[model samples]
Target: MACNGSYTVVIVPLQNSLYSSDALRFFHWLKKLRALEREKDSLWIGLQVLERTRFWYQHQLDQISQRNARVGTRELDEEEESWSCALRSSMQRVNGSLGSLLNNAYVCSAAPDEMDASDWCLRWTNAVLTQEVSQKNDRISILEFEKEILLQQRDGIHYF
Candidate 1:
């Protein structure tokens, strides 16, 4: 499976049963896909707006910084320079994280063309449940290991 821009593409071998059993059901599925596409486009537009706003705010900040630099003493200028460097670095990190989060938020499971909605849903649900159970088991194991270590420490202290 390959994915880009909030959509999943499933590549499967051609099969005899590739056609949908119910035309109306397929129509509804197509409608839902269109709705999702519109939502995705809206989200992209909102992100672009936010980017423009951020740029405008940064431009204003640069003007203020320049004004301060012109009036401030040498010592204050040095301090301000360092502070601005730190602030810019932090801002870049935050912006990078936000971009990553936004990109990742759109990813979702999608069914293959050959699979019906019900089968795809069931498969997805099972996969999620299996992952959850595995994680829970790992947590339980860690707790048990910690408990054993604590008990051993207590025994050693009593003997001492």
Candidate 2:
């Protein structure tokens, strides 16, 4: 669902399957992956990359502006130097995390294209977008797993 949400805006099969029990397990897997992503985020590594990019680019622009030499130059004329720099540097910072974001580019900007990652993100996002999606799956799984027991009680029959 995560990748589906990010990659396919028009709706896809993966998006529809997020309601299944197996898909829910995939959702749980995604939760673990997101937890790790949160831990890394807590380290401020992402922030550092952003700040590094922002600070450096502005510094470069400032130097250029003060020199009166960068005037009218393509690099100088463009605004949001920090943004451009941030995008590039953030990609570099999360170089190894490509799989985490599913390499969707639209989801987390840091995810890779690995199968596990794509699976996790889709499941994670599915869980996030709708609680009922998960609750329904959970209810179904419990019923399925305990179907025989439930049937015995309801039918007043004893097991061999």
Candidate 3:
């Protein structure tokens, strides 16, 4: 009997699962916000880049979801594995470039339901675009900052 014979071992860390969930939530929220941003009353639409962006972001969301499903279910095909690995790497790389506060590990002070994590994630995304980050560099906080900017901007510009 060769001791080297492989034994099946499945290990799924809670953190990895949470991270994937966060990624999905973030992407989903981003999709909706992009839609809202294209209503001729939002910034991206005001810039006239919403159509191209909606297409681009839709593609990204699909890609990320597919990859996450494969990885989460351990059904990753060669192509899916490649894509999943690439997306994870890209996320990690982009994540590293961002302030740590913007990483996916942030915890909300209240329950996840108390505040919409999806919306929160969008805020960090906007902050990252603005090249700003919270003191701790948490991604959620970064998004919060972005949300603040948008609110202020909206309030300043909106006649109501």
Candidate 4:
């Protein structure tokens, strides 16, 4: 995420299941704001991102219900397992990042005079982005481990 030559925004890998084109556009817009040193604009965009994230979650849940109704309560096959894992990881990442943003917003609101507004906004945005990247990395590691376990299980079944 190199944005214009001013700064690099490290973002989490976009989960295909959750992030729509509009969401991605908003993220890029936020990055552009940061690049231009428009911290206030970035903060407002970040709040919109949070709202979009909530809607994404609700949409995902509704889709899941519809899928389950169509498929019944059968055990998930490998593809479904992979999709479910990715969805769960994305949901967790979104929740954690949103919570961090809300907490930072509260702290900033409670003591507006304690720090420069631009500085606070920049810091909060950076913190949220950092947490999202960390969570995505963790999810990747977990998914890799699960893959290894599944491969081993398949290999064992072949031998038996």
- Give the candidate number with the greatest lDDT: 4
lDDT of 2 at 11: 22
Native-structure RMSD, model 3: 25.4
lDDT of 2 by residue, 1-160 (tens): 1222232123224644768877776666665566555445533654675688688878867875774774555454222454445456644645545455456545543443345566656775685677566458656755664675567566875543
What TM-score, over all chains together, does every model reach?
0.36, 0.26, 0.22, 0.49
Model 2 lDDT on a 0 to 1 scale: 0.55
For candidate 3, lDDT tens digit of each residue in 27-109? 56655544443332333332454466467668989977776777766765554454455456645755475445445436533
| Model 2: colliding residue pairs | 1-122, 2-122, 98-111, 98-112, 99-112, 101-111, 103-111, 103-112
Q: Stretches of candidate 2 above 4 Å error?
A: 1-43, 69-103, 107-160
Q: Which candidate would rank higher by lDDT, 2 or 4?
A: 4
lDDT tens digits, residues 20-70, model 4? 986777676665555445544455666777788778878988988888897
> What number of clashing residue pairs does each candidate have, in the order they appear?
0, 8, 9, 0
RMSD of each: 15.1, 27.0, 25.4, 15.7
Candidate 1, residues 1-160: lDDT per residue as tens digits? 2125677554445434556556555656665675556446656766786889799778969987887787755445554565556556656865786789578765844323434555655765795698588669757765775676679779989999
